[model samples]
Target: MSITPQAQISAQDKSYSAKALVSIALAWAFDAMDFSILTFVLVDIMKDYGVPLTLAAAVSSATTFARLGGGFLGGLIGDSWGRKAGLVISIIWFTIFEFLTGFSIGFTLLFLVRILYGIGMGAMYANGTPMLMEMMPAKWRGFASGLMQSGFSFGYIFAAIIYRVWYGDLGWHAMFYIACIPALVVAIYIWAQVPESSRWRKEKSASKSHSVPVSHLFKDGNTWNTIHAALISLIAFGVTYPINIFYATLLKQHGHFSPAIVANTIIILNVAGIIGNILGGYLSDIIGRRAVLIISAIGTLACSFVFQSISTDWERNLFTFLIGLFSIGGVWAAIPTYIAEHFKTTVRSTGQGTTYHFGAAVGGAIIPLIVSGIAPSVGGLAHAMTYSVAITSILVIVLAVLWRESKGSVLE
Candidate 1:
């Protein structure tokens, strides 16, 4: 049972991969916090700026639309330069804008800063995810993917806490200012501790050209994979945005819940979401990615129905937790790993960024606008969101069934 030198190196790499995961997840959590803090305070922004619901929704949508460009640029930078470089730059870029969001003197300025912030947000995922996937041991990829995605939920919880503590007295601007500090720390940690992806380095050394052409994404029968991935991402974003963006507002204005109740309920939702993310990732590893996705989609649909139908305060809390678990948590856990496996190492970041952000632009951006616009006619925001979730969940189940499974895919 003597361990060979190669075996020893493999063991060391696995150890380093776990460390890298923490650093990346920290960056992801802060990114999520910065993005989600705005949602919790959307109504406050509207009151201060004297904008309509649709206009407030537009600010969120504008950020998502900008992410489309940011994602593309991040992927290109990742593939051309290095994952670390792409990630660090994206983090710094977003941190600056998120800090500036507090300084916005008017609705127009807030909108513009958020749009700029969206690019950095988009880029972080494009760069950080591929790096983690490449570094993680094959056996742990599913769990790692789930944990990484859970950072977003963790961030939402962070946002909720900050909102509850600071929004009433200090105002929304202080929350944004507070977010900048930890994010900068995460950026520094990643730069210092997280090593470049070995797979990316190997690819760079072997390739003649430093950059992979984006055109390659459409060639070699990959166009279908590209289209399918984008459609899946679009569906995920479409279902998610309507609910995540509006749920806080719904609790306050529609349900007439007090601020504490709204914030506490959101915290509960994300806690369940965090559990779902980890469970979904673990299940995907054992059962297969498509099966987990299908299960999550169906579960999400069922939970949304219960969540909408429930009447009592405790019942609402119970079902809201379920909605977060299945819809927000479970469905997203497998996405990064599933999407990353669709492309070769050379084009992985670009493919992921382009497809994910395309979905963000079309599904994430447009669906919120539609929901906000139709809320009055559809009976209310809850009705509109429920309908959107039902339709999109069906799409997710279909797409998961049709999509080729990428489990146990070895990175190039």
Candidate 2:
């Protein structure tokens, strides 16, 4: 077998060696698993709280909105303070809030719990992605970054297993409490295993403890570029997230699958997603970011439409798994690397967090509304997803054409 270009290039550097990457990846993976434990537990939550599915979805949507705020705060602080410190703090915050989520006696309490947890969860992609990028060697950055997110797919799979084992007995409250353990573990591991980004530390030493304002993300020549970039990311994320979270429920309700089967299917799809993130990110590093993205977008457009159309249990599981293979998995792997290459280091985390969260929140808010609204009129979830995916794919292509590669681009 021939050696890949990534392997050839990555052979020279060992900065983010196997152990470092694995530690980082594991922390992030658990973070994802902890955050999404709610998805598996949502049915339990709805039952316990006597809420509607839409309302539970709204709790997630509310978390998306809160993430926007958390991203801004975490980005600003992560830039000024240290990336590792920001992450450790955020993990602790999420842990506390997530544990609190179990104690929620009513909708108001649960909403508050999710909102607080969202604050920490929002900062995750912002800080974690950049921190991993800064620590790793450039030649291997794409793979490392993608691997970091691969944990998310694993985490989703883990959540499924956790639900499979526990959902019958321990209940959602216990699951949320268990979720808190991972957060604490990550926080402790971060304190022990990770170091402050050498790049950020150097900058901090040079700056002599001066604090930067949140507005700096848009100041200087960065304003319009940040806006356009964030908008594109927003569109991508807005379309992907809610759909992934709600997909099992969608199949259960519209397609009439058993809950156990739907959960099992989610695990399978998330497992496929792990491969997609790695494949997409690795390909982008080789083929040029734009080319890989266009392929992913086109694939997403097709698969999403196909996914929405299935009527039988097998068809639903197959199509949904494929959807994760293309859309949810592939898109996430490419996004952070794309953003990191665009802006300077000075504002990389901030810009990335702001733009990504902006996309996430927008997608969270709009897609559900659109999908739910059109589901009945359009005759089903599949048709609605087809229309939504088609439109989003076109827009992604348009945006991809407009945005150029930031490979080897200078950071401030």
Every candidate's lDDT: 0.89, 0.74
Tens digit per residue, CA lDDT, model 1, 177-275: 998888899889888877899999999999999757799889988898899989999999987888778888888887788889889888888898899
lDDT of 2 by residue, 243-304 (tens): 66667666667767665786778887887788878887787677766776788777778776
Which of the numbered candidates is closest to the native, going by highest lDDT?
1
TM-score of each: 0.97, 0.90
Worst 10 residues of 1 by lDDT: 303-312
Give the total clashing residue pairs for model 1.
0
Please name the candidate that would achieve the greatest TM-score relative to the true structure.
Answer: 1
Residue pairs with clashing backbones, model 1: none
Off by over 4 Å in 1: 1-4, 306-311
